[model samples]
Target: MKSLDLSLRQKRILHIMQHNDTYITSAALAAKLNVSSRTIRNDVVKINEELAPYNARILSLKSRGYGFESEDPKLIESLNQIETAFFSKENRARYLAFKLCFAEEPQNLYDLEDEMYISHTTLDHALRDIASQFSDHTPYIRLIRQKETVRFEDDEMKKRLVLVEMLRKSWNYHARRNAYYDDNFIEPKVLDFIIDLVSSNLNKYNILLEDPSIVFLNLMIAVMYYRIRDGHILPYEPPIPKADTSVYYACQDILNTLTDHLHCYIHPEELDRLYLFITANRLLDQTTLTRETAKDYFGPNTRLIAEHFLTMIQNYFRLDFSDDDDFYITLLQYIRTLQRRSDIYNEQYTSDFVKNDLRIELIIAHLFQPLALQYLGKTLTETQLIYLAYCLCGTLENFVHNHPGDKLNTVICCQMNMPFLFAMKRRLESDFGNYLNITALLPVNIKNSFDFTDTDLILTTVQKPITRNPATDTLYMSINMTEDDLARLEHLILQRTIRKIYTASPSPHDLFINAFRHEKTGHGDPYSIFRDMAADFINAGFVTSDFLNDIIRHEENSTYAICPGVAYIYSLIPAEKSAMSILTLDHRITWNTHKIRVFIMTCFTLEDMPITFRLANLFYDEAYDLPKIKMEENPDVLTRYYLSFIDEPLTP
Candidate 1:
């Protein structure tokens, strides 16, 4: 039998076919591999040629596409080995990283080129790319390529950290298959033992950790084990704070067990690091702890930082959280945990279910960044920001729920009979009772005389000439409301209620009317656009010159390309007054990862925070027609198009 050499894509196709008992179509393979059908066919031809000498072939049937067929056991085993080989770029990178980290001395560049079946330049590029990826840990860990030799040098602990990150990234990819047993770095039995060891110790100590946290701990421990066995150990002592006595003992036991199993003396410094890791990852059980009692568990600094954060939130968003003891305790616990493990934990573990709320959470998190740096002594990582955002979102929900007066004072104006009106009222209450306070159910005929001064929203079944209050928003719906009507009404209620919370008085129409600029051709650079738009606001007396620098700084920290072709940028520092500016371009410019043609810039006062949410929805809301906004040439027409989605009445 001849040795079969296959390309990465070919091996992938075979791997997929091996897992699936039936033939897969060329179109399906193309879609999975993100390639053209012609490319898949060409690859299949080459794969077949490679397998011919080994008495194995990829068979293609009419319409059914491709399948692998083999009668020889030795051929099957060889194919399996080829499938498991490090052929993919990501896998190859991992292999190189592991090799460099574990190498006894500098590896010859020529030798690596031959081993990876690549030219000298290709080998150099791969090593440089790896080095760039680990550039953040520069002094602590490095991939040094001196002359024609390559080696990883620096702290053993940093090397272990890099390995853990690589493993975590790989685990994320493999975890989707529900099998980490196939991981190449650690033996299956050793990985299982490490997981069990961590789990059992936590169980014995009455400490709790989320599933993802447990997986992270297991990975860290596995990496630590391998590094220790390879004669690499933590050289310096990490400062260990006084953790829970039980957690301390648990970590001690884990290290002792590993030391005995590996027959290697694990350094005492490892225990300190492990203690911090376990404490940082542990979850506090459902038992509620008051502020005074929480201090005892999380330390006094945790309470101070949590209080400072809540105060900042109140001052910034005007939503008070001082009374929410549970929120305070939760924030304190999170801060304590964050302070301990900020260095080790970097991967994003936020669940996908919260994706809908992520936009708002991100805004809140960005707003809290300065305070996080001030109080926590370090800037929050993206993952930490997300975690903090989730906590704040919960508090915001509580604030909204607790304040009944904040709900929109709604009135239904319909020309239907008494029973029909009553049924409509019941439905509105059933659907939007949380957001709407239905104050009246009146006939449309009485619209001339009815006072809407107290009402925040007016839902009319039929469009009738009525004397309406400027503050009260109006929505037209069918007698029997459709799903679209319900959805629109829900959005209106949410926007109106949030505006009420933030005391936002300017309607969407008013906002656009204040500052709407139609640029025939926008500058190619996004920063130039920002500066130009900021000057317009400054000239109009809505903001000072500092607004330009403020927006630039904010964009640097958190870039918001809300949707495709639309970049929403706002100042973190509230403007001198509440104002908005919309700059539309005939041509698109690159903003972050998005190609943006529309820039919605705002310099809103602190009280106008909810208006930001409403503006954000102009892009986020699917019904708003982003393409229409992008394509419209006239500023007045564009403004009207934007106002069409909002419940605010248009000016004649």
Candidate 2:
């Protein structure tokens, strides 16, 4: 159980991985071994099975191919211990892939047989297997094995998607483990130059790419350069009607520089695909992807569909995202791309994440499907609808968070008589002030279907559920109103009021030992307690020495404890330098006459101050339990208890 027995081929693969850092693709391995890539891939499976005992496994990044991830130096050192004849499936396949992908001249069977160290029969079988893998290829696209050598046909867009995806997703044997093998897919200098060139050109054009898009664009650059260097030329030609000239020209400039660096010939179609990638992902100041240019760029019915989609969101949400020019520009261009992609390929953006699978998004999907069916004559896929939902969510958040001065619309629902209803209405206006706009006053008897749609908060005196309104949260109040009810309702209406109060940040245990640092001792007063914790944060590069001084100064003036045996301290710092530390004492230590057995200190930027208050809220709510947490010696059980507090949901 402690050791694994590996085959000669497996040992060879391990040896290659041990010597090199780049991914070795199965195609490359197959060509070298004089066997099918399929055989090499199968052998890799057995190799991984053996590596299981050593806490190591074969990892594959889509475009990058396959490599190994192992932490144990002894396990890695064992690679040299295993005897091998230098014939690995990975080595052979790598050889074949290089030959087929990069060979300037056509590949001949005789030359391949000699180069691959295989018999004529084996070479013939390998070629047949390789050819069969690409049987579904459109005649002259990408790789097609002819009589002798492998021929590559240029199809830039498809090539980019395939290549980029290869570099992005990885085969994870253990999803829960953060076991990423960082094989610099391409040379660092080349990748850095490509990123800088693309970034500068886009900035020159006044085009803005979000962080995710920036990462994707870099990935694309890496893949494109990698492929072109390997001799997979995807010649691209521009279609008749094109996108924003600025974006097209910007991409052209970037691509030209990239191609020169890569020393490869690129087609216009590749540039066009790059333009499309930028157009779909980035925003421009000049409104380059406007609705006015629909005829030249988008499909015939795209404008109409986009119009209806925005209209539905505006009406349903009672907000106008269409007014946000960039929203329309970004979404309209993306929809056009979606239409084109659907026509050619049926690939979907799939994820099982809770954020993507939000209950509110489900409601939005229900409302959006009918509109898509009416406008496009078909329902959108869950992925497509979820994408639209994200756009809407962003727009809504911008309106809610960014435009806090704007009055939020709310519907007050109650079953009381006229006088009591009027009294409650007055109470709401008094409590919430100008922050809330009571859009509709629905009587208990008049209730039908207006409860759930296009509003911020629903205030109902009863606990009745609104059937159709899925996105908006409802606040229920008893017949007799109290300050707590008013405060909770106000919290729902104006999110900024709780700007300092966050639901959670890095989990409590994550702060201790993982992200920040933790200590458990019955030594020192408050100042010494803080100094010890601050040292860890400073060492972890989460804070500076000045933080220790600040903590002493702040705690000297104020108190962070609301409950017994616990004191939490925090202040605003730069975002990147923001960090937290947790300390638990065996006995209560006095802080300005306040005894504390547990102390959690936080330093964050202004933006992250909310998490501080949120944590404070949790501790205050758990007033009687601080001593219990301090005494809990089992790290696992204590960590789980702390994590439960961090999981509290924010208002949707």
On TM-score, the leading prediction is 1
Q: Per-residue lDDT of 75-154 in model 1, one digit per residue for the tens?
A: 44444433234455655666687778778899998888778787776676677667756754422476777988988886
Q: How do the predictions measure up, each by TM-score?
A: 0.72, 0.37
Q: How many backbone clashes does candidate 2 have?
A: 19
Which residue pairs of candidate 1 clash?
Answer: none
- The deviation in Å at residue 326 for candidate 1 is 2.6
lDDT (Cα atoms) of all candidates against the true structure: 0.69, 0.57
Candidate 2 overall Cα lDDT vs. reference?
0.57
TM-score of 2: 0.37
